[model samples]
Target: MQVDPGDPVEVNIWEAYIRTAVTHAEQDVSLVELERAAFYERCRNAYAVVATGESALYANLIIRKGVVAAG
Candidate 1:
């Protein structure tokens, strides 16, 4: 089987992201998404699984009914 240059990094990044995302979820916040560009722009620009994946994606934090009452 062939290997991808970004494979190893992607795997590692994914693991970290999963952990972080879980932490974020526990925070009493709503709407969970991945902030690709910002994530990649962080650190020494080492890993960017989401940003450089099939398509760069970002997070949209919606605090649910707390952010705004049901209209």
Candidate 2:
């Protein structure tokens, strides 16, 4: 798919949101904790799963972070 170069900033914003969601879901940790590859993998996995059920032409994802109770 061809993306307009003018939309890069918006793309990066979405990328950040996906990465943050992945970091939280996969590791239950902060985004700062994961290395780039691990973080990207998590986001990739999430996108793969979510995209299967996504019906919209424009990308619209909503990810919720699960709460971890303190022991």
Candidate 3:
């Protein structure tokens, strides 16, 4: 499951990664499915930003914002 950032992202490999995450999400089945679809959509429009001199493995990072309350 070691993926180097420089390598091209393959469809099957990406799908496998998504499946693995969904499996261990510990969320309700309905919510998992909803989020899974969102993930797939994000993948469909995904783009890679390759940086020069970046040799670190799995250097990609994802940050999601927490829910904000509407006052």
Candidate 4:
């Protein structure tokens, strides 16, 4: 997913926010090689965090992923 915040400052802030959030969320999990690979494999299930407070008009993207049945 691409995040274009137009201004460089906004882009930096957005990146920082994402990094911080991910860091906190993974604080309890052991990110080993195999676990990291499995996480990447499930990247399709990830959702975008829209910073609508920064810009409303351009942040109207809706990402819909279809559900798949388990074998």
* RMSD after CA superposition, every candidate: 11.7, 8.7, 10.2, 10.8
Question: Model 2 lDDT vs. the true structure?
Answer: 0.48
Global Cα lDDT for candidate 4: 0.41
Kindly list the per-residue Cα lDDT of model 2 for residues 3-47, writing each as its tens digit: 333555333444555576766565654333344455456666663
Over 4 Å off, model 3: 1-10, 28-71
Give stretches of model 2 more than 4 Å off: 1-10, 26-61, 64-71
Who wins the lDDT comparison? 2
Best by TM-score: 3
- Model 1 CA lDDT for position 29: 35
Error of 2 at 62 (Å): 3.1
Give the TM-scores of the predictions, in the order they appear: 0.25, 0.25, 0.26, 0.23
Provide backbone clash counts, one per model. Answer: 0, 0, 0, 0
If ranked by TM-score, best first, what sequence of candidates would result? 3, 1, 2, 4
Tell me how far the alpha carbon of residue 16 in candidate 4 is from the true structure, in angstroms, after superposition. Answer: 0.3
Please write out the lDDT profile of model 3 over residues 1-71, one tens digit for every residue.
Answer: 23434668543444554666679655532212224445546555556534457444343333233456699
Those runs of model 1 whose alpha carbons end farther than 4 Å from true positions after fitting are 1-10, 26-71
Give the Å shift of residue 25 in candidate 2.
0.5
lDDT of 4 by residue, 1-71 (tens): 23333544322344444465568663432222223345445554656544456553222233334455599
